[model samples]
Target: MTVAVATIGFTKTTAENFFARLKAAKVKRVIDVRLHNTSQLAGFAKADDLAYFLKTINGMDYVPEPILAPTEELMKFFKTDKGDWDVFSRDFSALMKERKVEKALKPSFLDGACLLCSEATAHRCHRRLVVEYLNKEWSGALTVAHL
Candidate 1:
């Protein structure tokens, strides 16, 4: 079976609660796809801090892969697409493959994995695009859950 992916929003959730829910879901690792791993949220700023909390405290693996960060070329193309979500989606799928998202998924291959970002709503973030691309192109069975 394909690995199940989830997206969790850490916007207002406390670290403790977040970890608890992740544990409950049996998440083996969390992939932070945010362009900026640093969070405005006081406790989640540094990747090291997040890693420590997830690994040392919650016993989960953490990987920061910013595949959704818009590059210069991507930005330019986006402007041409004129906010066409489908175009953005198609391009992102290609980018993910080029970036070897499959390789990145290796760690979580044996267990459930979740992506994380700052936005409380998945639909409002680039994560939705990523998830949709994975679902369509990579045949990824991902469910986005807002924390």
Candidate 2:
């Protein structure tokens, strides 16, 4: 069976819309793929508050998997270097390969999981790269939905 994995970003969206989208998708868990989820800028997306809200609002589980996140150096390069998406994607893909995330991450954890990040959309986010890399590694077994 093909595993269904969804991706979402919290910026430029309201808490009500965020929860509503997750509920609509029937996501069982949220995998936070952010390097720093507790930054003051995170607002409701902060780890502790996110966990609480996920449970209270939609009865969903929250899991912070930093292993799926890009390194600080990588993020700094992307943000500071005028954001070259191709170079960022190439480097991030290399990082994931080096980390062997395809082997380390369990399929069960991702089957019904939603990858969470701060980008308003998946077009220019590491979360998209992550899923694409995983799909390639898994032989296209993952059906990725960008939410």
Candidate 3:
């Protein structure tokens, strides 16, 4: 069976809409993939609050998996150092390869799992790259949907 995975971003969205979307998608768990999930800008998506919200609101689990996140250096290069999308994408892909994220993760674990990030959408987001990388490693075992 194909492992189903979803991706979502918190920015430019409301708490009500966010939780509702997850519920609508039947997401069983949320995998927080942000390098900085505790930032005040995270608001409703903050680690502790998000965990509580997921459980209390959707009866879902929250897992912080920073290993899937881009490194500080990579983030800086893309956001602060003015690196292009192509460069960031290549570097982030290399980082994921070097880290062997595919081996670290199991398809079962990702089933019904949704990747969480700060961007408003998966386009131009590392979360998209992550799912793509994992799909490749798993020989197209994953069926990804961006929420």
| TM-scores for candidates 1 onward, in order | 0.70, 0.97, 0.98
TM-score of 2: 0.97
Residue 26 miss distance in model 2 (angstroms): 0.2
Write candidate 2's Cα lDDT for 1-147 as tens digits: 689999999999999999999999999999999999995655899999999999999999999998999999999999877778899999999999999999999677799899999998999999999999999998888999999
Residue range 1-147, candidate 3, lDDT tens digits: 799999999999899999999999999999999999996765888899999999999999999998899999999999899889999999999999999998998999999999999989999999999999999999999999999
Best-fitting candidate, measured by lDDT? 3
Q: List runs of model 2 lying over 4 Å from the truth.
A: none
Clashing pairs in 1: none
Off by more than 4 A, model 3:
none
Report the C-alpha displacement of residue 5, candidate 3, in angstroms.
0.7
Provide backbone clash counts, one per model: 0, 0, 0
RMSD for all candidates, in order, please: 4.1, 1.0, 0.8
Better of 1 and 3 by TM-score: 3
Candidate 2: residue 21 Cα off by (Å): 0.3
Candidate 1, 43: how far from true, in Å? 1.7
Pairs with steric clashes in candidate 3:
none
State the C-alpha lDDT per candidate. 0.69, 0.93, 0.94
